[model samples]
Target: MHNIPIRNLSARLVDPFQREYYYLRLSITDVCNFRCNYCLPNGYQPHPERDKFLNVDEIRRVVRAFAAMGTEKVRLTGGEPTLRKDFVEIVENIADMENIHTLALTTNGYRMAKDVAAWRKAGITSINVSVDSLNSRQFHRITGEDKFDDVMRGIERAFDVGYQKIKINSVLMKDYNDGELAQFLAWIKHRPIQMRFIELMQTGEMDHFFQRHHLSGQLLADKLVQQGWQLQPKGRTDGPAKVFSHPDYQGEIGLIMPYEKHFCTSCNRLRVSAKGKLHLCLFGEEGTDIRDLLQSDNQQLLLQARLFAALQGKREHHYLHQGDSGVRTNLASIGG
Candidate 1:
């Protein structure tokens, strides 16, 4: 609490590898309604207890500390962040922070239909909707729920609520939704939304899931190019997605290959799980517990020091292919 002075806007959380992190993916809760086969298998139990999650005040202070340290963007994630009762209040508080220039959200789009208007009013810059399969029956099979109709309605409601640039995220699986690539491309031909085809990662339950359904995102992109779609650069410097748009269509497409192609060199984000654990890498097993540290005295300085220490040791790239990394918690438990 007595050493380095707070640098405010000029401060950057630089890791030993020299990558500066200015984006924070804050998980509000680990509780989710949908039980996706890829994220949560039959026996997997997420953070089912609400009391264990960080309180609204704790969340506000944590974000404020990061904001002071030059966090320009904050994306609210969760098992489903909108499932939390204080979802609106949390967004509002983050929006009020001076240093946060952009606020984005990633959701399964289950409850977004009912809350899109509130999200629009709260200054949410953009949204990423995880719609794995467009087919109703296959959607139910993959997600273990029949909310496909509801999710589609939510995406439509987001457009109606004035969300200009909505992104659709679909995890490609070999035997699952892989056959829908052409269908997905056709569906977005005239739509304004950018559909991103993500490579299925080897996360928690995904080890077994990968055996039956691991499709490469690069192959899908090749097919798009073969079909005469112009792969123009998106010019976005922040996210991991390699975005491309076509001249003939109104919509755009992207590919996120965290497994096949790791973009860790340009990785500039940190994740805070619902239980207040600060994760330097998405696949990292070690993390600093902010929940306990926040309860300590001289919170600002303490948080600053701890955060800086965490950054100093941030790994250059996550060891996903290595056996050590696959033994972590469920993907839903980590964040969306």
Candidate 2:
């Protein structure tokens, strides 16, 4: 499937500011199994109206609409996408689209052992596994679950299935996993997986969470350098990671500092929530409701027009830490 030739869209999809968006983060469900402290805290209730979410056919048509507008890649996210009953079907259908060049998955890795091979067969080219803490006790504390061993098994299965580009996404918090930096660096010394450390962002209930626990990726990298780890720049870039490789390590280490806002400059992706809202920025509360357009009389034409209008109104950057700006809903609902 990697050999599938590319084709150009008749009309390119460009934002009002002239930024070409070629990436789409499509969330299939808002239901998840694990509740991470920063994302879904205790007593968090799931979105009750499951019937309101788009079904398989609606998802296919919506993906095609985005693909037709020059969306080169689609990354499936969720509260946990594997929690979707039709996860395989949804992924395969999107993978079958001719205009979409790549399909990816961002999962909690709780079900990777059972689903990774099927996802790979369905044309998923890359994966991001959320593993906040390597220590089982810390993992349970951070994610409100005792599934650290399960996640480890999932990662092993993903690797055994030949996913060389597996990325481990760790959300760094000062009082939490911040001290695990050395442990993570050592863990990647002989593995092929890329370790990406992300600075905790002020999202949802985590708005106040970051002020106390936020950890800087720059500080971590600088610490690694001070500890005598040689860091060299890696060629090529994808998504928002700042990639670096150590001479003695087999895997690369990456940093994503959302607070610094460096990644916003080359922002090329848009997000579609499970409820069919097109969110131009991760921190935006308001979005154009594309679900209604998808169910309308002339979906194709209407979807095209609605998407353009949404993109035209897209914010240039998210103001999460400043003023009173930031999304109000939990990350699960917004598919972060």
TM-score of each: 0.92, 0.91
Give one clash count per candidate, in the order shown: 0, 0
**Runs off by more than 4 Å, candidate 1:** 1-10, 43-51, 230-237, 296-298, 323-327
Per-residue accuracy of model 1 over 194-309 as CA lDDT, tens digit each: 99888777765567777788877888778878877666653322678877777877788888887654568788888898889898877876678878766643587678778888
Q: Which clashing pairs does model 2 show?
A: none
Candidate 1's TM-score reads 0.92
Candidate 1: which pairs clash?
Answer: none
Model 2 residue 132 CA deviation in Å: 0.7
Error of 2 at 242 (Å): 1.1
lDDT of 2 at 213: 90
